[model samples]
Target: MRIKVWITSTVIATIGVAAWAHTGATGVVLERMQGMSAMGESIKTLTPMMRGQVPYDADLVRREADAMVGHSGEQMARLFPEGSGGGVSKALPSVWEDSEQFAALAEDLKTAAEGLKLSAGNGLATAQSNDSGSMMGGTTGGMMGGGASSMMGGGMMESNQVMTGEMFANMPADAAFTMVAQTCSACHQKFRKEDE
Candidate 1:
């Protein structure tokens, strides 16, 4: 139940944050925004499955994970070439100033999505199991922020620090999804411009 509410709320918040239109965006910025929106929609598709509102299909989970995997890593990195910022872009200057960290976070997203692909069944299994204890713990702001939310303004990524691929290597699909979400949050909080 905690997981369901958290995931839904997070996704919703992310989309809400990204409610800002891409008005005036051009070139790579627009491309990245579209990519992020697509990812958000993918996550939205999985939300029901994640919450057990819909039946979980391993194939569907893997396919969605593939979508996330496809949009990330180098494909994601290229969206932020040196001069792509400014004008309608909400990207903060830190993206270029802290290039290495920014790029590493992008790679982390790829790694987390891969883990999600590998652990497709485990996500819904855990969701359906009613296991005890706090899976989300400190993740208050949560889930959706960055992937699409960040790309679109990255969504409301939580305050949880980034997790390493090694850490996510054997996690359940739900947990791996969190890893991806947190990475998105971390990047956007650090890099994206605030909605104000």
Candidate 2:
């Protein structure tokens, strides 16, 4: 009986974790959540390399960037319908209210992801050079691919716009990774609701 109880307890704990991860979300909201989770996982996989905590593998970076871009732009936005934020969703109402702006942000995300993929192929130096100035001085949209320009001080574009000079020649890959991550943060800050 003691062994049975322990097994039951373990099962319950596993179920609890699964439920918490889903957060009672359903339908399109659930789909979006799962998509976001996938993106986060891909980023997590690349973080160590980006941080130089692990050796940088150009092939791995390119593969992960492709994973991220798969869900970007129109493909990602389509998952969020007009009223899909109804069931335990973390999405804000503004998603439907200001959809055009949201669409633009999605495009920016796509651009950033594409740029990262290309940059990884080109070498860390090239990626750092292309992304540095744009991350700092570009519009807020450039960062988040969501329309929260105010959060970032102003609107910015995606990392696709290259900086052609000696300015970022010495910048590191970690900085480039941070800039890319910031773009995701910018949108989440504006569009996602904090857990209660």
Candidate 3:
């Protein structure tokens, strides 16, 4: 009787663990997915404008960049609590194990989004001056600002007026957007499962 009782208790405990893992983990997976989805939607909104397929609208870029910034940084890191990576989660083990790296990537995303917003609202020069090349892969001052100055014949790009659609279409601001996208891709490649 004692042996039978022990076996029954073991089975019950195993079932309990499974249920706990499944139910508890589902909420975290859903939350993180929702946050990521919002970021993706923002990227989709900006791409057409960057490509000149649609009219360039700085206000629209600022709005979407703000949304991207909102979804990133500490807000993003909070979505992945400890032990919340199993079950249906697309997040890999590295996200929790190498958490500092993950946090750095999140911060990088925020910086890129902020740069885009600054460029859209203030001017491309503001974004270039602020770039540290930490998130975007290269120095904006050297690559973007210098290049743009030469392209524009070395005069400061007018900061007060919204860029003409033609000027916006041809602007180096596209590089800023590209850097943000690349940062996202790098994080996904390192810490997210492809099947997910």
Q: Pick the candidate with the highest lDDT.
A: 1
Residues forming the 10-long window of minimal summed lDDT in candidate 1: 147-156
Residue by residue across 98-130, what tens digits does model 3's lDDT show?
999888778777866776776674334334345
lDDT of 1 at 195: 60
* Comparison by TM-score, 1 against 3, better one: 1
Query: By lDDT, is 1 or 3 better?
Result: 1
Off by over 4 Å in 2: 1-19, 125-155, 158-176
TM-score, every prediction: 0.71, 0.65, 0.63
Number of clashing residue pairs in every model?
Answer: 10, 10, 0
Rank by lDDT, highest first: 1, 3, 2
| Candidate 3 Cα lDDT to native | 0.59
Number of the candidate with higher TM-score, 1 or 2: 1
lDDT, each prediction: 0.64, 0.55, 0.59
Backbone collision tally, model 2: 10
RMSD of model 3, in Å? 18.2
lDDT of 1 by residue, 101-134 (tens): 8887788778768877886755543453355542
Cα RMSDs, all models? 7.6, 12.4, 18.2
